[model samples]
Target: MGDPHPKIEARAVTRVFGRAARAVHALGPVDLTVAPGEFTCVVGPSGCGKSTLLRIAAGLLRPSSGELRIRTNARRPAAMIFQDYGIHDWKTVLANIRFGLDVQKVPRREADARAAHWLDRMGLTDFAAAYPAALSGGMRQRVAIARALAVEPEILLMDEPFAALDAQLRTILQDELLGLTQTTRTTTLFITHSLEEAIVLGDRVLVMSARPGRVIAERRPPFPRPRTGAVRATPEFAALTSELWELLRGEVGAGAAA
Candidate 1:
């Protein structure tokens, strides 16, 4: 019964920065959607406005024109996890996770309980008392995820959350993220530069054009859920990745030339 629904919709959304003669068209009128319980990844070269698009969806940045709508059954708004993890270095992991709930005016005891639950779920229970500085990159990211989930938001928007981690750590986090998504069934929109990562995590991959970014193509992986490391080796996976790479290579080259 957990059928996909339109949890987030972006229709003809355009974003421009600066004034008069210096104006920069960061994003074109892009149309996109994130379905309920689906993980959609947006991949493109640098300056493709992937992060800008996500910020707009999270309501951090207003679009110069067009519309972005987030709909969910929950009263809370969507939560965002940034590439830097965005944790308070001075605060304990538990404190950081509880921060959102506190802002929402949830009771202290209730917030602490919810934070504890997610910390345990994300395997951060042992580091509850530790500060961001004391944890490794992966642990910091887990705390970020726990913090976002603590609020019980209907949607999760991630802007290359694993881009800074090492290869090994990134792989581990990818699997962990998938597990979390499966268990909670949260609607997610993830942005990444790694095509392999996009294929691994995304139900649908949206490839964007360079500069004045727009959705160039949308590819749905043929594989089923509960995807594991083995799926990447299959012929179907290879073909899909190759096709995306072919399309992306030209955009990346064009961006470089500009």
Candidate 2:
């Protein structure tokens, strides 16, 4: 039977660290849901538990309280991309692409086919033989992203995946990632500090408060898709981004103070 639950669901999920006197509440009482094939962008100030939320969702860290449910099938589990390019210096671009498929025990030929597909799709065909060190920062991140997508995961969690690159390269990679996600229809939760990045990449942008973070506001961008060029110039886009900034300003200052 088809699953009735959301692709990803979190009910009053919270995370705290340390004892009573030194306790640091890192996240919720947070509630969140990402529908199948939806791309939701999360934004907040530094140290706002945005990355903490992703780690919890990715199953890397257990929540101290609340229920976090991820409905994933055997063939398509969740995958993650961190802010740092998660690639192996020793592995060739093509080998990195094949990493996840190999882990799944996919047949050699089929794994090669799938990895090759992503490498080409990500515009890394020319660099297929190169190691991570031989590639530029943007190229390495693309390899990381391609590897995650190559797994054909039902849900993808990314924590500021493109934050390391220069502005121009970041934009290019953003477009590439957006196009790939559209094609795959993968359910994704993307965490970023850039409001424009969130707006550009998200179907809905969730803004969180400072430490002990929680979603304080959200913007479901009405901008039409293929969200490529020229959309950011529109008044509506500006208005929505501005609203998001206003929501985040105080939180950013608070984060800075503490």
Best candidate according to lDDT: 1
lDDT of candidate model 1 versus the reference: 0.91
Best by TM-score: 2
lDDT of 2 at 119: 84
What would the per-residue lDDT of candidate 2 be over residues 90-177, giving only the tens digit for each residue? Answer: 8899999999898899999999999989988888999999989888898889999999999889999999998888999988888888
Give the whole-model CA lDDT for all candidates, comma-separated.
0.91, 0.89
Error of 1 at 19 (Å): 1.9
- TM-score of each model, paired residue for residue: 0.95, 0.96
lDDT of residue 76 for candidate 1 = 74
Candidate 2 versus truth, CA RMSD in Å, comes to: 1.6
lDDT, candidate 1, at 99: 88
